[model samples]
Target: MLFNIINNVRIICAKIVQIAKSGHPGMPLGISDLFSILWFYFYKINFLNINSINKDKLIISNGHGVLIQYVLLYYSNIYNFNDIINFRKFNSKTPGHPEKNEIIDASTGPLGQGVGIGVGIGIKNKINSFIFNKKINIINNKIWIINGDGCMMEGVSYETTSLCGVYKINNIILIYDSNNISIDGLIVTYFNENIRMRFTSLNWNIIGPVSGHSYYNIFKAYKLSLKSYFPTLIIFNTIIGFISPCKSYNEVVHGSIFNKNEFNFIIKNYCIKYIFKKKILIDNKIKYFKYFIFFYKKKYFELIRILNFIIPKINYIYIYTKNRYNCINKSTRFVSSVLLKNIFILPEITGGSADLSASNLTKNDFIGFFKKKKRYRYIKYGIREFGMSVINYGINLTKTGINFCSTFLVFMSYMYSSFRNFCISKIKNIFIFTHDSFLIGEDGPSHQPVEHLKSLRIIPRIIVFRPYNFIEVIICWNIALKLKKNIVCIILSRQNFINNEIKFYNVKNIIKGGYFVLNKKKNDLIIVSCGADLEICFICSKYLNKYFLINIFSIYSSNLLNKQKKNFKNIFINKKILFIESSNDNSILKYKSLYTFILGINKFGKSSNTKELLKYYNITKKNIIKICLYIIKKKF
Candidate 1:
């Protein structure tokens, strides 16, 4: 049966790649036997039971070889055979890469992220099982990943691997497809490191450099993995393109498709003789489906009961307004700490900073670090930004917790790959970034963020907010909590902010992303800004009003404002608008209204005091006043 499954997968994979005239088929050919054992025997999955929490997860970390995953899923009856023919076509669920839905949970193609994501899923289930009192029968499952040399070489893989060992994360089996080949010929040309020694150093149990095509060896190794108490790394060495007649073990076969004659010859000789005539039989699917349906119904009610204990039950108004004990003139991160305190009080919030809790203001007295203590809430991520981001997404996948992680804004670049995956997957998590803009005082250029704001804003599905005052801070917090579909990034500042006039601003109107905090009557110039720059806008608006009537608009989230209807455009369009920001002004440039001039820092900031930095970059209140006057003169 294993041999038949492997041969059928190879045939289907060959046909898909040959017809599409694209995709990497070498991995599918080399790793088919291993996938055959995984999907059929080891992985306890019910294709029809999408809601069952007991379903084991399989992540194809080397996403280029996703055709193998698709083929196995088709054989398992999760997808129709017709969908296999439309592989890589637009709008098809069987895309070149796997997307999270009923089948797979992580959309992976870029190397290393899938491995990190797999580790995240492993951690989530571990935490879940802990909450359920270690009842393996209730929510026990495994996070399995098949990664190639590319994933092993990526730094994020090493980070996740090391963390997995440090935490002693269990039930994760990473199968390394060691073909010793890459796109540029042998992997030895670039990567010759001893993987066994490396994984052993990281405390992972190493299995074998066994033959990938041997069913007995693969099954025996997997049996050993199921009994291990720690994370395991299984190594398999196989020919790059094993079954192809012409390109067998060739590097060109890593990504190239065989011609018609070559494919036809192979199919005639191997597939025609060894293929099953009928669809693969699953004698126990009906029994498993019935059991899962009963399990789902029982678990559904149990989950509802669990939610009663986990859901937040607090007066939001009292928490934000009455008990807001922090100083009125507080740093945005300090305000974030106040909100996080209330948020952490909820049972489902679990996360901490990457060693920046003190600086990022993420430390809370209400929750202890989750260091070998299952009863605690916070997880000390220890400066691993990319790993932290991926793990946050994984925790959300459990549908059990609201995950969050904080770090300095300038360091978000280290997690760009994971951030891109976060945006693409639309995984719900609260990612709080502090030290926004160049206002961190003496931290100098390396700590300052000039273009990070615009870079994050351009991501299609993400919500980027820069709160100007405590009211906006509370509003963004509420918005982030209510969101279950997309990620929300709250960019905070290191400077102090206080708006006694926060009551005068329309509190309900802040969710519209942008609103006039000080618009009284018709005016000549409209001052638009967000974050600490809104304070500058306030000062400039006051001084500019003496010369020319001006209206002040505070944009809490420019992305959300752009999403508003046409009627919303009447507020700021066609008017002489002066955009003020301490960071890059590319976000405001998207609105190409006539008579607009942006004042922002487009270069690296210096090591100076807040006042000097603002003046050096011409971002002070007086500078904004002067720029408004110049724009008004030019418009007139």
Candidate 2:
């Protein structure tokens, strides 16, 4: 029966290949036996209860070979064989890659995300089963990821793997499909690394170079993995397009469509034992789906109830009250910690820092650390920022909680790809970045995020908040939790500031895109700034007012101008706006017409006191006065 199911899956994959005319059909053909073992024997999947808390997860990190996943899903009775046959077609349930919202877990076309998300899911289950003592038995859920040489070679895999080892996430298993051939050619032409030794060094259990076509060997590997108390990497040596007569050990067949004649010839050679036609087989698959539906509906509502009970309540109170200072302190990290404590009621809220728990303020006294055989409140993701972010997003897919990860602002670049995926998936995650901007002096330019703020701002739908004080940081956190649609990047300062009587309404105004911090004085020029630069604008405003009669409006959101509003129009019309920032002046160049003059650093900063650095960069009160004069002279 299992072999028949596998044969049906192979036929479905072949039809999908014919439709898409593009995809890696090689793995589906080569690794069918391993997938059969995983789906039918080892994997603990309740198709009737697809969202069951204790269900196993399968991540296809090598998404180019999506046919394999599609075939497996089809055979597992998740969908009818027609869905697999219609793969990569418009309006089809199955796209070229797997999308979590569409069918399964998070999307994985972007190599290494599957493994990274698997690590994250494992981390989440570990925390939930251990800390809450929910006796959830959910942590028993295993994460099986089918990785490729390409995925293993990606830096993100290493980052997530290191995190897995540090957290001792034993439930996660990775099957590295060592086909040795990439699109270009054999991996030996461009790649050679001691993968087994490398994983061992990271404290992961290393399993075979098992024969990819052997179900018994694959099952044995999975059994051994279950006995181990650490992550397992099962390496499989196999041909890329095995059993295809036209393509013999060829990289060309890795991701190209086979012509009809070539496909028919290959199918003839492979389908000798099976006497099935595509049209007649469709009815049989549909009949099987009817049985599956009965099982699914029986368990579906129960799982839904469990999800509702555990899922964090989406609170909008924070949206109304922007006073984050009352809840926490001026530090962004501190605010995040406090928010985590208050919002622990939400089962889906899980987070970890990249080895900077002490400095990042991600660790709170209330949150416990996840230990071996004991899940803790916080995940020690180690120093793997890239992996940490990927895992954070993955945990989001478990439908169990909200997730987050933290690191130094400079290290954010390492996880840019994963961050982008987070935005794409619309995962409600808070990245508590500390030591924001050049305020962390002497760490040098490498550590300073001079352009990082603007770089993150470029990503569409990502909310970048640079709070001037602790209160604003709290407000930002609250706003982030409420606006779950976008990725929230909260930039924190190293120095502390007083949380003055900044009205929640004003902060709320800021969240609406942009708001005038101070009403435009009849005779004063408007001053605009964000983050640490806001303080400079405040000081510069006072200096400019002393030198010349001017009104200073602290503009927070630069993108606010794009919104059509009557009040905003009246504020910007025929007015002299002076924008001040500590970073590059070009950061606000797009709004040059709205501003009379832009004062900011155009060159790299030097090692010095924060004050000295501000002064050296000409971001001082004197420079502000000079720029205001220059704008007045140039315009008036």
Candidate 3:
């Protein structure tokens, strides 16, 4: 009976790939036996109360072979016949790469990111268990990661697996589908590293080299996983194209659609009592194995609220807002750190840094390293930026507090891949990027981030909140706390100086995104700025005011300003505008219709003091004043 159901599902899995003309048939066909045993037999799911929060998370690292997951969902009755049929089509539940949702655990398309996220889920569950369970271990739901050969090759897998070892994070079962084949054919030439030795050295317990075709063998591995001291990695020796006649155990079956004869032969050769239909009646064991997926549904999220934050955090921030002196002449990073320390008092608001805790100031006094003992809020991620980012993303999935991690802004380029995916999924993860721009001097062009600000700003759906001042940092952090569905990055400064403190008397005007910093006089020349370099804008505006009435416009959140198009556009229309930024971010280019001038750095910076670098890059007040004078002289 088990073989009968598995056989039918395997054929259906192959057919779905063939029908879509664009999906990997190999993984589903290869791991059908393991998947059947795992999902239908051992995986604990609840169909009745599907909103069970402490549910198991299944993250498929090799997202190209996403059709297999859709097949599993279809059989489990989570998805109907139509959803599977529309695979890889427009606006379909099952895309070419599976996106993270309620049932579909983590949105996985980028290789090994799923594994990284799985580690995060394991960390989250562990944190929850520590916080809520109190010696009982009630929140011990496992995070299952089904990864292919490609996922093993990806650096993120190694990065996360290493962290998994350090934390001794149990309740994570990584099922390695060792097919020996990928889209580019056999992985023998490139991926020859000893995976077993690698994982064992990383302190993960291994449960396989088990026969992937055998249902009971896979079942036993799942049973062994329950008692694992550390996170377990189950390596299943499976054939890529299990039974597709000519295409079986080959790369052709990976992503390519079967030919007419190949498709016909697969259907003819393999049939469950000659019944080739989408709907199949699997046995009761399979039917009863329903489990909850932790709340990824949009409507459910709407119904659910983070009341823990709503009651205290907003009011908590108001304390800082009222005190006003908390941000006086401080670096945005330093100010944010003060607020972050206060926020991290909440059990839900977890944080860490990518081995730059002292510099990033992400780790607070009370929050120590989250090690095997598991007695703190901060996770001491030692220099793995990509791993730190995706793991923090996984923590955000817990939907507890606005989870944050930090790295220098220059290194953000390393985290762009998984960070971009988080943006795509709209995960409410706060990634703090300090040392924004060419200002952090003595550290050469290598350390100084020139293009990072623009690079960060361009990511789709990502809220790059560049707080222009310490006061804005307070407001930005407050806004980030309340944001329901946005992946936020609060870019901050490393360098500090004491200027006469300026205050926004009204928080509402600051929240409007684009407000006039200095608009006392009638405006002739407009200088627009964001974040770290607003001091330059203010100085330039003051210097330029002698020739013409200068209006300094500050955009705290360009995303928020973009939303207010009418108001934003009205400020730049046919006006003598000059936009200045320390880095390559020319805010005026977006207002190309307005003919604005930019005094922003296009080239890299040099190893010197901030004063000299500013002068060298022509980003000083003198440079901005010259640009403003040029615009005034031209009278365009």
Candidate 4:
């Protein structure tokens, strides 16, 4: 029966390859036995209860081999075989990659994200297990991540695997499909490290280089992995395109469809003698699954509402800095620490650092370590900024109300792709980035972010708020909570300006894109700024008022100017609009011909004190005042 099932799955994989003409046919052909053992014997999944809190989660990280997963789900009576045939077709449940809503797990074709997300799920499971105890055994749900050598080669996998070891994620199992072939060529050409040894060093229990075609070895390995008290890595050594005559063990077979002769050869080698091509059975399985899904969705929504109610009742706060000055109070860090103290209600919000929690002031005082159960809130994500960002997204995707991740502003470049995708997916999360600009002295040019401000500004549908002080940081936190779109709230690590008189409006205005900050006299120049840079404009305005006798208006959001016609004209009419910012000047240039003269750091700065760096870069009050004086004098 198992052999028949495995043969059927291979045939399905071949059919999918024939249809898509562009997919990974290798792993499905090679590791069908491994999947069969997992699905039929080792794994426990209630098809009727797909979203059951205790149901084991399986993530196919090498998403190109989605046909393998599709076939298994179909044979296991979860989905129909037709869905497998419809792979890569539009509006089909089975997309080219495993999508979150479409499949049991979200897959990233970009590599590494699946493993990172799996680690986050493992962390979430552990927390849930501790919180609910016997009432709900969320930790009982194991996380199975099937990855290729390409995924393992990615740096994110290393970062996440190390963290998984540190967290002691016993319920997480990583199945490495060691086919040795990648898109370009053999993975050995580029990656020849001792993978098992590396994982062992990270404290992971290394299982096997199991025979990919053997059910016995695969089953035994899985059972051993389950019993292990640490994260497990099961390496399956197999040939690419195992049954295909011409392409077996070849790199060419990694991501292309086999020709007619090659396809026929695979069929002859793998298919049973009597079965050429079996017609899909239109059984009541789909109807039953649909009925279950309907009830599951209703239950899920009810749970969401319940969670929403519970989330607000729980006191949780996030403090962030976009400019260097806001780090002065250390109150943002203090507030975050306070939230971390209440471990029970705020268990869902996991804080992480890209190896800079101490520098970024992200380390909470009360939560010493997360090693023991229910002890800590901070997650040391190592130096993997990209992995940290994606893991934050994954944690949020788990629908646990709030999660936060942070690193130096310079490291945001490493996390840019994942962060952009997180925004596109509309994950409601917080990102705290410190050391925001050139003013971050002594770290030198490598640590400074000249274009990052402008780069982040271009991402559509995300609110990028750079608060000037601790009060604004608090207000930004309040605003960030209500935001549905992607937001990058930038806070300063230097200079504290206490704005006690400023009235914080309901954060609803932030959703509208931008709003008015100071209603100064209508003038030719509107000082447009964000983050700590806004303070420069404020200081410029004060100097201009004192000496230059020029009027300056503060525009909080440049995005708002593009939306409202009247607001744009009212803000930038017939005046020299000198924009003062500490980062790149291009952010203000988009409002072109709004009499904008952008004053900001155009290059990287050398390591020095904050004041020295600011002065050296011409970002000081004297230099800003000089610019204003020049603009006024030139106008006259």
Of 2 and 4, which scores higher on lDDT?
Answer: 2
Q: Give each model a TM-score.
A: 0.93, 0.85, 0.92, 0.84
Better of 1 and 3 by lDDT: 1
Candidate 1: tens digits of C-alpha lDDT, residues 1-636: 556667878888988998888898999999988887877778876655655565777887888888887787776666787888888899887788764766676657788878888888887777666655322245678888889898999888898888888877777899999998888888888999999999999988999989998989999989999988789999998888778888877899998998988887767656343444323332233555456446566554545544443455556778766646564777788877887788877666787788898988888899887756755768788879988887777777767767888999899898777777776776788889999988887989999999898888888788999987677888898888778778899999887875544447666667889998776677788888888777767767767778788888888798888887778755766778888777775667666566778887789988989889877888776767777878788844
State the number of backbone clashes in model 2.
13
Score candidate 3 by lDDT: 0.76
Cα lDDT of model 3 by residue, 1-636, tens digit: 677778878877878877888877877888888887777666665755444555677788887777777877776677889999998899989888756777677758888888889899888778766755532343567788899888889898889989989889988899999989877788998889888899999999988788998877887888999898988999999998888888887887877888778877877766466332232322223222221113224322322344234525355456566554756677888888877767766666678888998898777776767784574778888889999888887887766556888989999988989877887777878889898888788989998888887887788887878886656877788778778778888998887754333544466677877778775546677778877677767666666677678877788788777777576457676777777777777755776444677777778778999779877987766666777778877744
Residues 469-507, model 2: lDDT tens digits: 554555576667666567878777766543342434464
Task: Report the Cα lDDT for residue 157, model 2.
Answer: 91
Model 1 alpha-carbon miss at residue 234, Å: 0.5
Order of all candidates by lDDT, from best down to worst? 1, 3, 2, 4
Off by over 4 Å in 1: 134-136, 268-302, 305-314, 592-594
For candidate 3, list the clashing residue pairs, or say none: 45-290, 45-291, 46-290, 46-291, 100-107
lDDT of 4 by residue, 1-636 (tens): 567777877777877888877787887887787876776666656665555556677777777776787777776566776777778889787878654662466666778778988888788667656654332232377888889898988888888888889888888999998988887887777899899899999999998888887877877888788898899999988878877888888888777787888878877885463232222322223454455446556544544553563545433233233332434544344333333344324445577778787777667655545676543556777788887877776666666456777777777788877766566556667787776777666778898878876777677866665655444455556556556556555444433333332345445444344544654565434555665566566656665655444543334445544566665435455567677776764765555453567777777778788788877877777877777666666643
* TM-score of candidate 1 versus the correct structure, residues matched by position: 0.93
